[model samples]
Target: MSTTAERDPGKTQAWGAHAPTGLAGWVIRICHALPGTSRIWYRLTRLLRGPIKRAPVRPFDVNALGMELRLLNRGNFCEMTALYAPQFYDVPELDWLAAQLADGGTFVDIGGNIGLYSLAMAHRLGSRISIHTVEPDAELSARMRFNAEHNGLSINLAPVALSDHEGIATLKIDARQRGQNSLQDGTANGQADTREVPVNTLLALCQSRDITRIRAMKIDVEGHEPRILGHFFDNAPETLWPEALLIEHVHDDNRLMQRLIDALGYVEQGRTSRNLLLSRASTTGG
Candidate 1:
């Protein structure tokens, strides 16, 4: 069949299952200590083994959040890069997102990738807060589910891709795709085995599901943020307005970002290195 690696729960290998930890786990923990050549050599060797026969159970137990995160080989390796090498994001932002705890609110994480922030929030916050995480990649979605369950949190996991519409679209897969927000370049030179999925707009989802209050929101849709933001503004009903928003602006299109903020009646709050934070206008017409 379809390899089933992404769908089989029994295949969800933990980091501790392999080494004293495991080879993958140790590779992740001591990755930073190794020299540049050694790091390259290690990753190449691991990659050649082909699609993680057994996933390493690297538990990124964020003590502050009271949750344990389980990552597969690919995710654990990326975590190493994010934690030690600091690619695409910084440490301060990671620390800030990890520290947040909600009493009883709605947190929507679009392009949540592998539950890095979603799991952290679910763990730190009380069980009252409802988490809605959407990820398109099957392999990553399966692992996200595993992490949520492992942490004893109930997140409404949607495996379908998110967009302004509800239909199928092609998804490019690149080995370099980092984080859950990873997407293929969407160009002719992209990688292979790229697939498509039915997409659902946030507005439609909220309208259909009766999502009234959005306490916090995070969007990391590669380069499709503008399209998503446009649709959100165009179709967002009166009842659904998020209090705080965090989105990645990888394109450097400041004008578009500003326009999106203005359309949504939100003012700039702050920036977390790579992402911009916006808050609902304190004095919107209401």
Candidate 2:
């Protein structure tokens, strides 16, 4: 018999939880001093588990980095990162993204997942900055919504997948790791363990939302970064390209992605364990 981490409500081990480190870890300790109501919500979700078979949610609110965020214990990256103080999540990437953004600018998170990046950026840069978080997974999107509301943060939530084309696509959900879900064409199509999600090209989303300026963007779409960005490059108006970008670099198309970014005049500035920080040449001082 196979173990049931996916189907069992009692799965409790965060086998790969975040081991907070460095100066970021110190900041996490400082921000850990705030109060949250997630304790009540977690017990509530646990009571609902017997009826639902699997508890789809577990509330985790940690006040860190000057903001409070509601998180979900979903047996994925959230377990690995967001459960800890936000500072410990991705120190370098978090700092880089925050520094590149301005107070009144706009930011887009293509695979917003549980809204950690959105929370971090908004908290660090100030609430005046408009943020749009895009996450296609039904469960994760729900968590994103809950977190945003609990933190008293206002942000645009795009509950659809982003793709090279506009329309519907099957999102392949990982049975165990929630963060591993993907809408890429290379993934299995129309399988039983999938959900058909609405998708829109980047250009279409901006136009529909009446967004004219995108100051910075952080994209981590599992393995589909190339396709998402390919669509952006092909369709986005030149004047609308984000001045700063933080893209996941550990994908199959790393080389191709580098070439495409270079062609668009982006210069590699730094990198974290899972991402490459890039800034457009036009945005730099002459």
Number of the top-ranking candidate, with TM-score as the measure: 2
Question: In model 1, where do residues sit more than 4 Å from their true spots?
Answer: 1-15, 19-66, 72-78, 82-91, 94-101, 178-191, 252-254, 283-286
Residue-by-residue lDDT tens digits, candidate 2, 17-87: 32334443443344443233444443433343232224444444445455555444455765434554343
Q: Write the per-residue lDDT of candidate 1 for residues 244-278, one digit (tens) a residue.
A: 67777666564667775766678776686468766
Tell how far residue 169 is off in model 2, in angstroms. Answer: 0.6
Question: Model-by-model lDDT, in order?
Answer: 0.59, 0.68
Which run of 10 residues does model 1 get worst, by summed lDDT?
A: 56-65
77: Cα error in model 1, Å: 7.6
Relative to the true structure, candidate 2 has a C-alpha RMSD (angstroms) of: 9.4
Report the lDDT of model 2 for residue 207. Answer: 88
Error of 1 at 196 (Å): 1.9
Residue pairs of candidate 1 with colliding backbone atoms: 14-56, 14-57, 15-56, 15-57, 19-22, 113-180
